[model samples]
Target: MSAMNKKRTESTETLKKVLRFIGRYRILLVVSIVLAAASVLLQLYVPILFGNAIDQIIAEQKVNFSQMWRWLRQVLLVVLFSGAASWIMNLINNRIAYRTVQDIRAKAIRHIQKLSLSYLDSHSTGDIISRITADADILSDGLLLGFTQLFSGIVTIIGTLVFMFSRNVVITIMVIVLTPLSFFVAKFISSHSFQMFQRQSSARGQQTALIEEMIGNQKLVQAFGYQDKASERFARINEELRESSQQAVFYSSLTNPSTRFVNNVIYAGVALAGAFLIPGGALTVGGLSVMLAYANQYMKPFNDISSVITELQNALACAARIFALLEEKPESPDPSESLSDVKGSVEIDQVSFRYTPHRPLIENFNLKAEPGRRIALVGPTGCGKTTFINLLMRFYDVNSGTISVDGKPVDQISRHSLRSSYGMVLQDTWIKNGTVRENITIGKPDASEDEIIQAAKMSHSWEFIRRLPDRLDTVITEDSLSQGQKQLLCITRVMLCLPPMLILDEATSSIDTRTEMLIQEAFDRLMQGRTSFIVAHRLSTIRNADEILVMKDGSIIEQGTHDELMKKGGFYHTLYNSQFVNTAE
Candidate 1:
């Protein structure tokens, strides 16, 4: 296909997709269209009442109040009816358009949740946020404005054409010649504005990302004296948006005036032509008056057409971005078939992964564990410990490896069911603003009060809960609790869920010594029957762990018990004695 044909075909497909997104709203859409048409037809007719009044009195020399009263009544009725129809049109259009936008947002949120780890790794949170929120708003505004104006413009143009041709064909034809010129104006403006508007939208998204980063890390910015740097970048993005938007506005601004200028020149030429007809007894004064009214009204539809065409380009740009997100491939293929009784057993063989294609973080890694085996993974920062747990959870798929639970391939199981088998507590855990009871027992909402308290006690969070004025009903959150308290509650949440397998990724790095010992006791209680993978930086916490794997550069360099590693005189022995053994002495 030729390049232009290819572009048109792609645009047609995009429009088809947008209409598909508006599925099931056909009834409301049809009704809105009909009401809008009725409103426009009535509005167009009401203006013709003046022409009738002038012709009745001026041309026929008849002074009749009944004729005038009749015309006045009809005009009032048309105005009232049009007003009612316009109201109905607006209500129905707003309802359906907003509903469609709401559905888009909800669907995008669900789709993002199902998307694979690689997809999220490729885009930032800010980019996705702008798509679901800002871009959807752009679509809604453009669609409603374009659809309503396009319909109203069409009706007005049709009415104007009928009236003008009925009065005098020669003058009407002279004016109609300028219609093609209006089209040229619209076409020129839309083409010039499309790419500029697209750039502005992109710049807006970048600005959103920068502002979000600033808000999320105000403390870091202050500590590093990076406010000036952050502000400079933000200003640059802001100016980029301003420049693109200004350019798009300037290009489109020509469309209206160019159209109106051509229209005015046509009007002057038509008036002169009509004057010749009037002297030759072909047209009267009333006829000339009526012609001008019809001619002026006819220009309105074309004016609106020009305006709506510009908005159409904007909607098209937003639709392309939205569809791009919708077309992204999600993480894993979720199974429609359900599997039950997922055992906590996990095994990884020959697994390799990297957050990016250029860097390989985990290579040829292998591990094995069954029910009731607690393995402690000890490694320095950035040593693939968290990546290991992420793989087991199937948050990410391995580039070349096999990881499974109960002999079922992780890819073959539904993501929901696969994730339900394990619970997690991380060092930098998030505690939403809610009561203590809500965070725990999140998996099982129907868990009884007794079960909630039991989970809290097992995680050693009960002591802090007892101190709260409301106990389980206390509104617990990071703002309300200390670091130790938040960790305790996070552990309590894991305990409440009672998953067969648990992952603690540096889960106890924040507590003081007194609370740390209590938390360790709680950890032992929580791990009584559950198989656990513990990622810990503090060597003392994993001293009694059943198996300890010492990792370096994503590979296990050594594996043994605490006493066994201390006797090996290897990397573990040197590191342990330097960091922990000497402190103990």
Candidate 2:
């Protein structure tokens, strides 16, 4: 197929998707259509009233006060009703359009929440946000304008054409001949402009992603003195966006003027034709005037439609992006088997995995932790310590192995139940803009005020919490608290839950050494009678762990207590010595 044909097909599909949302609010849509038709009918008849008043004046050779007065009142009443109907229609359109878009946004967000971690890890945060907010808004605005203009424009064009046919067929024929010229111009420009608008939309998303990334990591950028590099990178993307936007606007902008030019030519033809007919008694002055008015009304709809079409192209492009996100496969279905009466005895058997097919990351890893054991995974960076934890958490499934907790394969258990059995505190903390109590109680919402305070105190977070302006109720803005405070809040959240299993991935990395000791003491109490896996680069933290598994390149090279591993004088010995040696120097 030709490029235009391909675009037309895609546009039709996008339009169908948009109409599905409209179909959801069909009742409001029907009412809006009725109002629009009523407005168009009322407006269409006003020109007839004007023609009658003109003929009465001409026939009397003076102002026919009674006839003209009656015509004036009819025209005024029509104008008033038309304006009221149009206003009501607009109000209904806005309600229906906005409500439908709101529903779409909600559904998209819910789907995003259910998406697998793998999917999220592979996508950019800013792009996903842009699709949900910016692109969705564009679709909403476009639908609103399209619906408002589409019904009225079509009704006006058809109603005016009917009136013109009744008054004079010759002038109507002239109009019929010229109408296609306007449509052709609109179609030609829109076809090319659609691709440009799509490009512009993509560029805008890229720019938004860059801005979100830079702003989110502004501290890092500034700290590293890479502000100029960030600015230059942003400038390049911004320039591309500007060029795409300019091209898209330039082409779509041609639609209105080009259609208007055709309408003007058709109007000139109508005037010329009406002049010859007036002398032959084929047309009265009033009839000629009504025909000209009808001609203007008929052509005006084309201009309105053309503009709507151009805007719709941009909206459809954005809709396509949003729908693409919604179409992603959600998390795998949950199994009927579930963990119950959980005692955290995690066992990894002959596990083999790879992020990519050809390059192996984890190979035949094996381990067993009895209930309530503190198993520390110590390894050099990229030696699969974190990857092992990810497997146990079931964030990524192993290629060939079974990770079981309490004699049940992880895959056999429902993800919700499996994940709820563990309380995790990672090195990177996630704190939302909410009250301090809310952030701490997120893991266990039913936690009472006293319970929340107790958890905070146990995690060494209550000292700072009590000093805040509102204490526990103080809202935590993004920049309101320090990184260590955020990590403390995360740990406090874990303490409140008190799950059967715990995973701490460098949980105290952000805290100062003094606070770390206090938090460590608190964690010592918290880890009692729970299976805990601690992943830490600081070997000092896990020296007293029950069993320290020294990992190297996806396999366990050593497994014993901290002293036993150090006495063996191998990879763990070297790793431990290097850390303390660095500290001593």
Candidate 3:
């Protein structure tokens, strides 16, 4: 199919989706439609009243004052009623428009929660935010305009046609012949502008993504002297956005004026026809007045519609992006069965996985961790140590073979139940905007104040917490606390829960040496009766671990206690000595 046809098809589908959302408030929509129609019909009757009063004044000496007064009063009543109906219609339209926007935003947020980590990792945060906020607002504007203006415009056009035919069919035929010109003008302009509007929306998303990136990492940008480069990149995107927006607005702006010109021709044609017929006495002066009025009314809707076509196109483009997000495939669903008695006995048998099939990352990886065993994973970067942790937590599943906890395959258990059985503390700590108490109680919300304090004390964070002005109630944001404090808070969460299994990926990387030793002592007590997997780069930290697995190129090259590995003088011995050599230097 042609490009125009493809766009038309996509637009039709997007319109259908929009209608379905509006359908949720079908009762209110119907009321708005009825009021719009009533308003237009009442307004249409005013011209006929004026026309009748005009005929009453055929001659100054032959004027009927009482009859003209009655017609004039009726016209006043019609105008008042039309205005009232129009007001109520607009109120209902506002309600529908805002509520639909709310629903769409809520749906997008809920869908984002269900999406897989891979999908979110691949998409830009700013683009997703733009789709939810900016796009939804644009759609709200379009819906409001469509409901308030489009409905009444259509009714006004049809009502005028009926009124005009009743007065003088000959002149009505002339108006009808010229009416299509207005529609043709609107259609031609809108068709070309739609593509430009789509381009504008895309560029706007890219600009948002870049702004978000720069704002979130401003320190890095300054430290690396990337301000000039970032600004240059932004300028390029901004220029593209400006060009697309200029072209879109230029084309869409033509619709109103072009349609208005056609409407004027139609109006002039009606007047000329009416003038010729009046001399023949086939039409009265009042009849001619009514026909001219109807002619203007007939073309008014086309003008109104043409003016709003810009918003309609923009709204459709935004809706398409939101729907694309909603269409993303979520993570695989879990089974109904949940893990009931998690003993932390994890076993990986012949597990093989790769992020990209062409480049293997983890192949035939196998391990068995008995209950209460401390397994330390030491490896160079890019050796799949973190990937292995992700597999155990079921963040990413293995490509082949079974990974089981307590003899039950991880895939066979419900994700919520399986994940809750383990406590994880990673190198990158996340602190939300909340009070210290609230952030610490995330793992176990029902924990008492005493329990919260005990966990904080165990994690070596209570001393710092007590120093704050508000203690545990102090609201903290991402930037409110130092990196070490944030890591302590994250560790506090694990201490509070104390799940059967633990995964610590350089959990103390941000803390000072003294705090690290203190937290490590607490961690030792915490791991006394739990199975734990620790991924560490500092070989000295894992010296006392029950077993150390030295990894290279995604495979384990050495597995033994620190003393046994050192006795062998293999890969682990060299790695351990290298770390100590760097520390001494």
Q: Between which residue pairs do clashes occur in model 1?
A: 115-331, 116-331
Candidate 2 weakest lDDT stretch, 10 residues: 56-65
Candidate 2 residues lying further than 4 Å off, grouped into runs, are: 1-4
Model 1 TM-score, 2 decimals: 0.93
Q: What lDDT score goes with residue 60 in model 3?
A: 65
What C-alpha root-mean-square deviation, in Å, does candidate 2 show against the real structure? Answer: 1.8
Clashes of each: 2, 0, 0
RMSD to the hidden true structure, all candidates: 2.6, 1.8, 1.4
What are the TM-scores, per candidate, against the unseen true structure?
0.93, 0.96, 0.98
**Reference-based lDDT, each prediction:** 0.80, 0.91, 0.91
Cα lDDT tens digits for candidate 2, 179-201: 99999999889888888888888
Expressed as tens digits, the lDDT of each residue in 364-467 for candidate 1 is: 99888777778999877888998898888888888898987877778778777877878888999788888888877678899999998888887778988988
Candidate 3 residue-wise lDDT, 384-492, digit = tens = 9999988988888788989999999999998899889999999999998999999999989999999999999999999899999899999999999999999999999
Q: Pick by TM-score: which candidate is best?
A: 3
